[model samples]
Each structure stands twice: as C-alpha cells, then as structure tokens.
Target: MTGTTRYLPPGRLSRAINRVVAALTRRGLSLWGSRILSVAGRTTGIMRSTPVNVLAFDDEQYLVAARGNTQWVRNLRAVGRGKLAVGRREQWFTAVEVLDDTRLPVLRAYLRRWSWEVGAFFDGVTADASDDELRAAADKHPVFRIVPTSTPEDRG
Candidate 1:
C-alpha cells in the first residue's frame, strides 16, 4: 500500500494473449468486457494499443492500471487522452489521473470486478479487502477518470 509500486511487464505468453484479445476487441468483439486502449507513444508519437478492462462507476467510467506504472500509464500521463475501441465502436476521451487519497473506492470496485483476471497484480488484496488495506495499496495502482471528448458526430 504505502510501499513501492509493483510493476510486472507482460511475459511472452501474456503478450501473445493480449494481442489476441486486442484483435478481437478491435473487430467489435469484447471478451469479458474488454476494450482496446489506443494512445500515442510519448517518444515516438505513434499509436500504441493494449487491451484494458473498462470500469464504470457512478455514471463515470475509469481506466485502471492493475499492473502499476505501465507503458500505457506513462503514455496517458503524457497525452492526457486516448481512444477506447470495442469492435467498430470507438470513443475518444480525456483522462484525469485520480488522486491517491481518492483511489481506494475505485480500487476496491476494480478488484471486485476484475480480480478474477488481474488479482495477482494486487499482491494479496482481494475485493473483500478492508478499507485500510485498499488505501495502502492505492499508491501502486493508477486510476483515471474518463471524460469523453466531443467529436464531429456528437457536435453535429
């Protein structure tokens, strides 16, 4: 919780699984509520994508980095915006990183929803974890509030 953030890069097998999931999500198929997150690389300016679980809470959507301080996190920090695609549906949105103190509920909700898939990244914390435990782990995970950007279609 109050210790260093944990970062576990995808292994070769994990990368391959992600690629497959991304392909499906891009083509309009969401595997267990997944989306392909596309953001521009900070250094190269090229589009980078990875599969992510989108969390909806209290009429607000969020993107949580379960793995902690990942490439997408850095990229989002740089650009403050990105696109999420599921199938042919795409949404552009600006991101605001949630503050550390406010991240507990979001983190708890995320674990409750996605722990089956990403629980290992949270050290031993579970969705049933106490508030204090969750607060402690807040520094390791980054949560972003998603604000949809106005697009031409929406404007018209």
Candidate 2:
C-alpha cells in the first residue's frame, strides 16, 4: 500500500461490532454496553448523537471515532464538550480532541489491549481512512475525548 493510501478503511466493522456488543450487553450477557450519546454542534447548535463504544480506562472515559470524520465528531468539536447516557447512567463531560500524533500511540496501545474486539481495525479488514484523511478528519470532525468534570457515581 502506498504511504498515502490506508491499510484499512474507517472503523466500519468496529461500529458493527459495537452494535452487536451493545445488543448482547443489553440482553444481560455483559454488565455494560455502548450507547448513543448526544451533543450540540458548536456552529449550528443543532443536536446530534451517535452510538459509541466506551471504556473506563485509567479513570477517564474514552470513546473511539469509528466512522472517522463522522458528523458527531464535528458536533463534539463545535461544542468543545458533550454528555453521555449509557444504560441508565447519565452524565456530562468536557471534550478534549486528540490529535493524530497523540492518538496513534494511544490507539495502538488500545488496539493491543482490545485486539480481539478491535481486530477488524488491526487486521486491515476494517475500512479506514488514510492518515492524511484522518488528519483532515481530525481537523474537520475531530475525536473528542470525554472527561467528566464531576465524579460519575458507579451505577454498576
């Protein structure tokens, strides 16, 4: 593959997996599942939401930008923050957009840790935008790392 070309597409498979996992988790197979969180666009002020696979790693909640350059990313960027309601739990959090340089290492690490789950991305089976494309996306859509301003009570 050329340096400009992507080894994989955006996280299409990851999203599909998220959907399935959420369904299974909701069915009581797992304790927690992903959810569709809403946030308002900074420019238009329109409310938009998307389902995201979330994890509580290192005390901070994180969400992956599966679609890469999807509108939800833009919404997070515009508002510079957002809220998430997963299962019966609801809370608001501030967003910090993760740049590629910062994101790559983290994503790599996450991929390593969650390899079986995120296999599609690592195996090049997932559709992924190019690095340049993702860069443009970060500039356009942006990955908003949600960090809660207050302590979210454990609803588990």
TM-score of 2: 0.57
Q: Which stretches of model 1 miss by more than 4 angstroms?
A: 1-5, 152-156
What C-alpha lDDT do the candidate models reach, one value each?
Answer: 0.85, 0.54
lDDT of 2 by residue, 43-137 (tens): 77776765566655555666665434556665675666666665556667887776655554345444455546555544342224455543443
Flag regions of model 2 displaced more than 4 Å.
1-33, 113-142, 151-156
Candidate 1, residues 62-105, lDDT tens digits: the string is 99898898889988988888988998888889898997767788
Native-to-model Cα distance after best TM-score fit, residue 105 in candidate 2, in Å: 3.8
